[model samples]
Target: MRRLLEGVVPGELLLHYLSLLARGRLSVEEAPGLLDGAGNIDALIREGMAYCHGDDHSMLVAASPDLVLQRALARMAGHLAAEHQRLLDGQERLRAIQAPTDATAGGAMDQLVQILTDGGKIAELTLTLAGSAQRDWLILGARMAADASDATSTSANCRALYESRCVASAGERESVEAVIRAGGMVRLAPRVGMSMRLADEAIALLPLSERNPSGALLIQSSVIVGALREYFELLWERATPYGVPDVEEGPLPPIQMKILRLLVQGLSDTVVAERVGVSVTTVGRHVTAIREALGVQHRFALGVVAVQQGLVE
Candidate 1:
């Protein structure tokens, strides 16, 4: 729900379609396309809601795509042929209802027919990503495009959190902070070697390389997601919370504040001195004072504490 609403659609949608297909009630082709707009997303969402309520029929019947969409679905037959028989069985079951059609039957029957005829293009896209060796690149491009187009991607009812290690390049740092400023609760991890990101329930695992050229795997299975959520909570427990204060508490002297800010940027002591127009000895003194004042043992920890306490921008 987090990833889908937050615009991590390709992975989440693929996971959703796979789960639905696994149910044996529908095939991949029977699923509506991802780029089918809010109409299909809404349909799938309704199906999910119905599933939650144990009313399988509502989902099976409410999302019948029209004839043209069905025709498009037929072209997906090559990949979806395996499920044809099971779907036919379901249709036959529907047909066996000799009783008078209830108010819901008409709508549900149409949806079932639609599902039989539907195949989502977005699902196909994610499938390609899933099998590709270079999926992360494609997924990243898709996410960037979605980010550009979506103005209201986040859900108001949900809490948003991010853990950044600040090892990202300067430009990437700005972007991360922009996301944090936009309703995200940011934290600083002590260190990280993995290339990963989580959007709601979806977890994107990229190659460990700095550039992450190989691709990414977006997993949304319940077991994996739930476990990952627990792991995230554990990591969060050890992370330093980042809440950029409107006003720096205790108001360190202007020079000390400058030093902390540069240090968080991963600046060296010499560079910090150059930037602040202070001598190396003076910069070291301030660094030591900042650490002691924050009750942290080292400058690295001081930087983390500074960001957490909003002592540094």
Candidate 2:
């Protein structure tokens, strides 16, 4: 089983500990002795294969092998899904790069589109454009919050339009709020099909496809940049300003309210527990109670509903 789980369990020491726990060869007390300089018993506990108890003398208890395997497989599935999305994005970028370039007024395609295949180069160019913008910066997408933040910090006026569905998660909401708080304007559209940035009407950065961070087309041609700016303006006119709901709800207990604020800020359960001076289990219980109070099912929806109900700011 250990050999089969080679890459799945992450580390050999952790795998050995899991196997020992599953085989009942390692007792709770004896487990601590196995923790040498290279061994990390906490890894097993974090992966849901083991747990600790007792306040003064913490003891580790192993979970069932079935539960451990299930959790490991679930984590692997998540990684595979992310990788599949990346592959699709890469394919889309490849197709765009291979397509015929458009001719300008001079009947030449020179310097119209520059393919940026390196992620670091893409980020550096984005930052440079944002920092150098003196008039205005326009953006359309979910992942350009950092660029918007930079633009707002400069002398340039920044305006961003994002799809409502794409910006629903807590982390996304927090980022959008950060941009707004930095004096940038944000609007929500029903759908934003592409990721793009236009700086001062001189240059445009368009990702090859949605969610493709590593590849983009940097366009300096005035014709294409002008068209993209017009497209952004048309969408901006129809989009709604980013604003919180006007509805109000009953107040929650002080502790729950604190937890709710942290949750809305996109803090994880473990971090929230530490900040609130409570156990993770207790924090989870409060999370469930908060969800019920707000009438939301998932954690993402919980943050959205909490903000909508004016329960947390």
Candidate 3:
């Protein structure tokens, strides 16, 4: 031990320690104290232990080449399994979110049409109309609403298809009348300021800046839709179902329609006559014809009727 690290340790003593180390009779950590810190034989033994023998560096510094390879393969297996699970979970979530939203709905009109067309899984629909409601849209709403319960198919499509009800804002009377004529329950809400159209499953929240009423956010979340349904029911409960009043009628001549358009544009009879290429008296006659046709008695009522019926822009 004294001569081992002193640079003169005997080969026999070195072999004895080496044999002991190989037989597990000595540990590398324990062997450091058996030397005097010098000697080629001791240094050789330490070098062989540090570099060649798997127990020193391989077992202590890190795993051996073969064991390291096995561990790497195991980790790869675990990582692949985890990734497969994550992918499956993601796919399931995607399917859940996509299923309900896409198969059932689209834009406001599309949703309305789909619901009205299906008619099953739905009971009653309450529709709100804007003053400038498009004739085509109004017709679609009314006709579809009526057909939902036609009693012709006998498919039991609707469990209780109540009368198609509508809440129309002022200046929407004509469209309201169209719906009413199709057997809808119509209520004229005079002071009700127009917002986007509201229905049972979907509601349109249109930007006020957009002129197109269909330009809207179609909300479909069940909580929001259910709340809207409840509120509309409240309004429907209090609303009075109105019918058109009876009065003497006159046919609306094409010239009378032109005169009415001109009148609404802040134009006088003379201006209307010039625009229509007719005399002022002729324009006045057209205006009178419009008044009689509309069931109104005077010029102001004619304008009112024009607005109510969506005759102007």
Candidate 4:
């Protein structure tokens, strides 16, 4: 009952009941039962008045009149909390999607031609190019078209083409950060590498890459663009939005991540003890803590789980 009072306040219970209605987790006819029935409410109210219990009476009245009315209206509206969340998520998705612009077939320049021919297209575009001379040449040509006064493309939306970021080592992460800071965009798997800050107007790879003769596959369709935008947005949402720290040589201290990094470097408890300036026993304590945190029964399994979770290089 103490724990119940701490967590499940009467007001909160009222809100949860309303949320159930909104979430379609509750039904209207069942409201009387959930509210402990009109007869029970009346009996409680009578007891409250007899004992001069103002608080209990207030609770009973609010639950009876306010909650019952709110729940009834919510049921009529067919409110379901899950459905409301979907509508909200859909709105967020729509905000991220660049409106569909005409992307016609003139090879790599199809998107460019479509935008120009349609006119008044002001959506941000992300272009990926392979590390080839022909693709570079095509990028140059596209830049020229983008420079035209009649072009609807905004200079703010045009970002630098970037290679996929590889996270084989911390040094590579530093290089990737430099490129991203210099306005480069990367295509990466969600949760593959260490999280990095990114620009808003970015691109992500589809489940499959498109094949083209020009060596640079132009992406302009709204559905594909929207999907990529959602992925980048998901990464951006999960990533440290601003004030990211620079890459350091060693892992940050006092967490399972730090212990796992040391383990990955082939350091035993004794060697790790000297390096981290803790005693062997203390290092063993850390190892125990890490194993327990990761729920692994053995030391060897710790490394396997750390690698899989991307806690180590």
How well is each residue in 1-313 modelled by candidate 3, as lDDT tens digits? 2232223333544454444445443344544444333353355444332222454532212113344334445666888999999999998897577656543233233233232333321112322322212221111122232222221122111111123334344534444543333323334333323332343243433222224322234454667655655645555555444553433322343455567888998888788888988656446544654564477887877777888877666
Give the Cα lDDT of each candidate.
Answer: 0.44, 0.70, 0.43, 0.38
TM-scores of the models, in the given order? Answer: 0.30, 0.43, 0.26, 0.23
Candidate 2 lDDT by residue in tens digits, 76-162:
999999999999999878646645543211122246778766666566667777777877877788564234355344446677888
Clashes of each: 5, 0, 1, 6
On TM-score, the leading prediction is: 2
Please say which candidate is ahead in lDDT: 2 or 3.
Answer: 2
lDDT of 1: 0.44
Best-fitting candidate, scored by lDDT: 2
lDDT of 1 by residue, 132-183 (tens): 3221111121122113211112322112233354525675466554433332
- Could you tell me how far off, in angstroms, the CA of residue 278 lies in candidate 1 after the best superposition? 40
**lDDT (10s digit) by residue, model 4, range 1-313:** 2232233234544443443334332233443466556553344333231111244332222233344544445554565776888999997676445234323223333242132221112111222122111211111111221222211111122122222334446764554443333222223332432211112323221211122112223344556545545544555444432112334622223433555678878888787767766556445545654565467899988778877766675
TM-score of model 3 (CA atoms): 0.26
lDDT of 4 at 45: 34
Any runs in candidate 2 off by more than 4 Å, and if so which?
Answer: 1-110, 144-153, 244-313
**Which pairs of residues collide in candidate 4?**
22-79, 22-80, 22-81, 23-80, 23-81, 24-80
Alpha carbon lDDT at 28, candidate 3? 46
Model 1: which residue pairs collide?
29-118, 33-120, 61-108, 136-215, 136-216
Angstrom error of the Cα, residue 265, model 2: value is 33
Error of 2 at 198 (Å): 0.6
Worst 10 residues of 3 by lDDT: 152-161
